[model samples]
Target: MDDQRRIFLATASRLGALAALTSASATGRAQNRDGGHAYPFSLGVASGSPLPDAVIIWTRILHDPLNAAATPRLAFSVRWEMAEDEQFRRIVAKGAASAAPELAHSVHVDVTGLRPDRWYWYRFMLGDAVSPVGRTRTVPAASGMPKQLKLAVASCQHWEFGTYAAHRHIAAAAPDLVAFLGDYIYEWGPYQLRHPKSAVRASESFTLADYRARYAQYKTDANLQAAHHAAPWIVTWDDHEVANDYGNEQDERLDPRFLQRRAAAYQAFYEHMPLRLTPRDFAHLRIYQRYDWGKLARFHVLDDRQYRADLACPPPGRGGSNSVQPRTCPALTDLGRGMLGREQEQWLAQGLSSSPARWNILAQQTLMAQNSQLPVVKEGDGRFWTDGWDGYPAARRKLMDTLHTSRASNPLVLSGDVHSFFACELARNPSRPASPDNPLLATEFCGTSITSPSRPQTRTEQYVSMNHGIKYGRSDKRGYMLLTITPSDTSAHFLVLDNVHDDASPIARAAAFVVRDGRAGPVRA
Candidate 1:
């Protein structure tokens, strides 16, 4: 069905849900054989893609969220209410959204006509049962400059590896926004050599139902649920959303059924997340949108996986992957090949150039800096992993060039998927370090994964040694970063967990850095 008809039906059902709030007859449609208990809100509630005037509130209804029989063919009417006060005494908006079975009983309420730069409390109701109360805030007015914004950066939470203790901490800290840079769910199935053995699933996620089951498993975690309930999220996908290291039309496995798998995965992603726009097609999702937090920040959310060029080098006798030296492979310098694609690149440039926010943040997936691992024999040359920005040199250079000329005040790039923290000064040329003549144009803060295993600490040190512009890095611990942005300065605290294997592990600060408002690079603070 089209969106307008679904929305209209949903709005009309609000009165029905309200009238049935005290009745068991209407709510019986939501019940399943789970020993006479309601579990429709198992996945919890979430809000995302916040704007000054509107925000998206979402929830899925299922008695058995982890299995396909949980959601039947019939639709369930759901009532949602928003209030300015936590007590819900001050009601701002009230509406009904139908949990359509076709959409996996997922409700996406694009709430409009709300105040800006303020906190709002909301909840969902079915019959007499109410969901957990969630807190979400809209952005400040476009022309106004807000005092501060506390944002939590997170990504790459592989379920089987560890528990989501980091998300629990994020919920308690209560940032204004959460930026998930992708790898929300890993595509690989259960593995034998993983910690916290409780999280392993039985099979890989290929079909739409399989993907939905995977998401349900992850969302079932109490800690991850708490974080979603705490604040609105701005999410973008990486390679794992569809397949492992899949680029453009190519999957790492190079299976003939990759396209169908991608379509199923995309549909499942849309059904699960709190997004404003629906996908136009299976492989085509307009997730690369923009957001503004008053005049203080403008976030350019980017999609780097769908339209990116395939990996540059397929090492001899194997599939398309691994690293390659620039001197040996001349194709590494192809300016025509891209990471963000041509259209996204243009859109990003235009947005960055025209934005009035004090901090122009490029929130994207994967590393943007050149992390070279060139052999000693090729000392002066650069070679890098074909999976990140290093694979698309020309595109990275163009992005740097755009940042240098943009009218935006402070250009900050937030990245994830590397499973390590990297604080670096973005240079137009990575072969040379930042100098007085070649000034640094932007700063990048790459957050570590919440539960995903980190690379060797030695590898992080190696990257730092190879790239002089990189100021600080650590891969020994797993946690998220809390970014506090003010008009005068923006600072990041790397919050690390003592032991992810232990759910009760204590969290401590690993490192901290600040970038002064006008400065183009990060300074140890």
Candidate 2:
């Protein structure tokens, strides 16, 4: 066996031994929740960061999810088990992890030494309360190419706007993997204009405690919890997780204490997420990473918000995004200004160049293709939104150049955060038609939000009419994208809900597109 495989097996064996030693004591502690304490698994059980032989299962012990003070300062011993069946008749792996108050009483157990390409059921125990059974699966073996992979892409769920009916449908679909491309929770809440009756939080999240409580409130949704239990997730956050339209360390308000606020937000995100790595400190957390789905696909998950330059030429006093014409905003073409920053851009270049997978998927936030608000009969006439790829045209060109130079196979980008569904073609110059000289580099499908409201559908239609590269656009729907990847082609279905306000809304496919293997653009399927 390889050295890496051997080391993983050895670590798994050591963990197994340790679990055996603590099983009796842990079980005893679990039988009586520290003398009648409230049930701890209120938020839910989740598993993520899946590998061929391992997956990270997570849960936070919270007697009262909204009130952090309700949790004891002492560490709680949480036992977890993984089995091949829902009944857990044949236990495959068992372990115990400490739910420490320092980490918000969260438990993360990296369960390893399992076969690839199959489903496993897992759960956590605290006192006599057992968490909802979660189902997760490992990817295919490194050298193996699976026949297919079904992925559901979703994001931008504003709680008060509507119920999470989209997530309910996603759980019912039971995809192989779920990719959440940012805005897991809106930093602000209780708009009052939306559903004032069902407000989770009355104020915006600005501190660690506030962020934690906000996450707790969102996690209380049964549909969201069901989605977590349905499949393993791969997540990346965007602006709203910290503050809307914030890039790097700067908030839209340009608050002097933005970094401190960012630090708190980052900590709370770590405490709640099913991530593999812990943040080094409150000041910095690296969320950009890659995941391989066997030899079929490689997911280059990005962190565009944390390392990007401030939005170009915000209105004189404002610090957030604004629509502007390129003729008036020369800074829009600054070559030094970057979306992924230098280091991450270099890393992505290397990954795409060396990737052996058949499909290289860029799982990121926002749209990559050019979307001019006005008609672009000529270059300078088009008005662009400064919040997305249009804000950094040179950086977009650099990324397109990398894709062309590296020749990444079947490059497809999955995006969210615009609260709209968009199917577009990526090229060096998206305003122009794709020709031999100006070839397509990748295909993009940007999903609409789970519950968040978007602009009117007429505006989307206008933008689609103006932008030649955008094959489809729809802002009226609220839902997720279902992608089916095979050796031959990748089919994407834009699934939408009949009513976001209804908890039991019916879901239907709004559109469908397909990108053939080795092709770089999507077509109506």
TM-score of each: 0.90, 0.92
lDDT of 2 by residue, 104-148 (tens): 898888899999998899999876878767888899998988999
Number of the predicted model whose TM-score against the real structure is largest: 2
Candidate 1, 89: how far from true, in Å? 1.8
- Native-referenced Cα lDDT, model 1: 0.81
Winner by lDDT: 2
RMSD of each: 7.4, 7.3
**Candidate 2 clashes between residue pairs 3 or more apart in a chain or in different chains:** 30-127
Q: Pairs clashing in candidate 1?
A: none
CA lDDT of 117 in candidate 1? 81
lDDT of each: 0.81, 0.85
* Each candidate structure's count of clashing pairs: 0, 1
